[model samples]
Target: SGAPGSRVLITTRNVNVSRTSGVSEANMYQLSCLSDEDSWSLFKQRAFSGKSSDDYPELVPIGWKIVRKCKGLPLAVKTMASLLFCEFNKDKWEDILRSELWELTEGKDKILPSLKLSYHHLPSHIKPCFAYCAIFGKGHVFDKDRLVEMWMAQDSITTTARQCKEDVGRRYFEDLLQRSFFQKSRYFDSFVMHDLIHDLAMFICSGDCCEVVDGKLSSTSRVRHLLCRNERDFRRLLSCGCTDDLLKSSRTCYCVGDSMEPDDVDGAFFMKAMEGMFMKMKYLRVLHFLCIPEITELPDSLGNLKHLRYLHIYASGLTTLPESVGNLLNLQTLRVETPELNGLPRRLKDLVHLRHLCITGDFLGLTDSMGNLHNLRTLEVQSDKLNDLPESL
Candidate 1:
């Protein structure tokens, strides 16, 4: 034999990045957050292991209060618990529980200084990618593909001849994941950031690239990404003629809200407004309808988005993509969950940079042009009536 087998092990902050590095889920290991009881146990072992429980019974209650504030984060618990060795007093313990560090200020926090150090240690390329994740609301679950596509759209990912932008974007995601900036979701096939980590990102992006709309759009034109929480807020923002200004300078515009039945009554009018509005968004990279279920078709002007990379239309009502969809040569991810969808245009092949495609419908079949998507990496099709596989695939 002329060759030999090899094994490699890697440690990263995010699990998805570990998977991206070719480690199978079955073989991967996860470090779970410590439970409340276990968190106290670890803290006690480190802080009080040598002291008799009966010796410092007065400080027990205050210590418990302080530990609970750590929210079972081992590092936070450990950091707070270590303070006991230097000054084990009721007032000191109370001060930690009431520490101002719990409040995030522009990414600075005293509670978990070590975690902040980890955040600071991140490479320059991944720092913005992590900070941009603040665009998603707290506790919201998102997939790896969507985030990577958005990074590519933001031009955070660099491409080479052997790899496309999406591929490079994925590497960026993995870098963050391996470093523990992201965690796997317990309820969905997605990932969620720890509450403290999310706070860090939110603080970093504050008044910078990400803004969450409540009733009025910010006057600053520097807002590159916008998030709306509900339909009322969304409509309120659009009614003020904010769309024209926002789209002109924004790179990512999205709605993140609870699901609602498609707004059939106002759906057409909203779609028409968006169609006209989107034609002017030449620099737009991400356009998402969030949970709006009633949209049926993308505007014909969608092709004008030369820099578009991520397009997500949940609960779409249409059956086919417009032929102009072929014009989005830079598109990397397209996720359309439309039960009514029956087919895709053959022009899909024109999207040479397409990397991830997730569609749900009753498909006639895939086009032979699909084989032309040499850069495609993930294809998810949910169809009950689809039986045959395209030979070109």
Candidate 2:
């Protein structure tokens, strides 16, 4: 596609990817750390923006020391600079330069010390919101509203008397965005964390959040958040040697699937495994399944998750909710997106605390008792079969 003499440049953290692309060792180039002068220049540009370094003569010495600790890594330098951009305090700069986090030795594939310090410097309330992001995989695109709703479901947002939870959650997202923790995704209305930033989140959330991939769990610790990258990983987690206590301790479980749809046998296995898992995970606060494509029905035992607050399913084959769904007195948000679903549970009206309900299907089965859902605030239905609205609604 290029002129004969034109050269293609490829950059990647994984050497395997480079080799796989047919780049030989003779042609490969490993980047070295930047020189001291370059590092300082980059740091000064970010930390001072357009202002001259002379504007803050007192902090330049401390800034140089901090930049030296970054070892010429651009991301580390920029993150530390952003962390101190507006600060004019000498003591604050000195404190950052002398922090013990820098003394921590680097581990294989571990996050940079500067990134760790950036997370450490986050506000207390925003800390949990950021750490909770570890539940997602690297390169994951985040939806602002969906993430805010998830944070709300987890009680991560603290709202004032005048501000609603979504408003406060948006503020938290913007704060992170300003801090360079989240970058705008190429997709519209979405964002993504830099790979190193994602690593920092995973490192800080170590024991509390666990991710499963290729049938392997990142950690066996007692985790509150669990993520399965695909249906196979979820199945492996259910059938693997993981203890029942571990499942019982999880408060959030998210499963994301690829494009491949499951066969009849795989669907049956998935249903059986889900039933077994539902029986064990009693404390689950949020349950999400995206693109799994074979969930035709929910197990009755789902009602046993008395503490569940958020439930989301986006499978093409999902048909209906079990009647026991009404037992979730504390449930707040429910989102089911599928064209195959027939209707809602008849007892859904009993969930007085339900606030958000979104459904996409052929039949909604709305009843007069829907008026009992007095706390509902957001309602979205995508259906063509229904021609009339319930008077109670």
Candidate 3:
């Protein structure tokens, strides 16, 4: 206490000890985990690191689950990621999504319970930050200051994040990240949580969460998202008899993002397969159907979505487009890449509100139909080598 220059690194589980020791004098550098992207990147660095061939492309998406479980903590990422390097394949990823997920996620205590034990053990004042994470699930990423703003929006700051406002909130987030509760990206701008950590957060909310039985749905007010991935909880919504209520209550639905069949991701008709899912999800405002193989035609229901602002069907095998695209009066971003398929959808001639229209793959049909998009700022050119690309240009 007498020494002014004494730089001490205290490692105690008790929040009071650290609080009393440096409350007003010493500077605090709350540790956090690797950022979400970095956590996944680090996790994959080893898994995909020396590997080559076309398989790398398929493996990345499946690896996302494992990344989510690490909650962006480096220790967890380092430990569990070590397990992935040995089993680098789509089958391994599918296996991870299986029953043995628990062992792989929590096997290294540093990865799951151990990291969370530190978070849970924090002072009562800072507990809300940890508890609030249950809504986003593990592996989910959020901006630091933005998360602080949400806490303010939720009024959690009054009870918790009260120190330096933005700084305290940032410190709180940083502390969690450093303590390995939250993960930071290599870029150090964003954060992520592992999937297992997401489960742990849900467990923390047991007081608020209802036991959603199979064929039964549960009612929740404060919570916005429901995460029942593969726990035989399929028909569970039906049992609750409040599926419609839950739908209106939730702004977004969480489901298995990865398609069971990897072939669908690279094949020529992947867009059609994804279109089937899009047609059923009427409430979705933002949908990322990345890496579809190909689409010969667009689903007609797309026009029905007057609320759709962003539609991403990138990295696919695409040729022609559905005329109904112009019908989406609210459309802002339309992404399609069909380099070999040379043609633009004629319907887009009237989509004046669109700001970005990207085409990467072969569009064997498009010539100069894009001139209609007067408001577009960004565009992806798709066509064979030509003397003059868009005649309008």
Candidate lDDT (C-alpha), each: 0.73, 0.85, 0.55
Q: Global lDDT for candidate 1? A: 0.73
Model 3 C-alpha lDDT per residue in residues 204-269, reported as the tens digit of each score: 665343334344434455434454432234223323345444444432333323332444233433
Q: Judge candidate 3 at residue 180 and give its lDDT.
A: 49
How far does residue 131 in candidate 3 sit from its true spot (Å)? 12
* Top lDDT prediction, candidate number: 2
What's the TM-score of every candidate structure? 0.68, 0.88, 0.41
**Between which residue pairs do clashes occur in model 2?**
none
- By summed lDDT, which 10 consecutive residues of candidate 2 come out lowest? 257-266
Q: For model 1, give the 10-residue run with minimal summed lDDT.
A: 105-114
Total colliding residue pairs, candidate 3: 53
For candidate 2, what is the TM-score? 0.88
Tens digits of per-residue lDDT, candidate 2, 52-103, equal 9998899899989999999989888888888887777899889899899899
Task: Kindly report the root-mean-square deviation of model 2 from the true structure over all alpha carbons.
Answer: 3.1
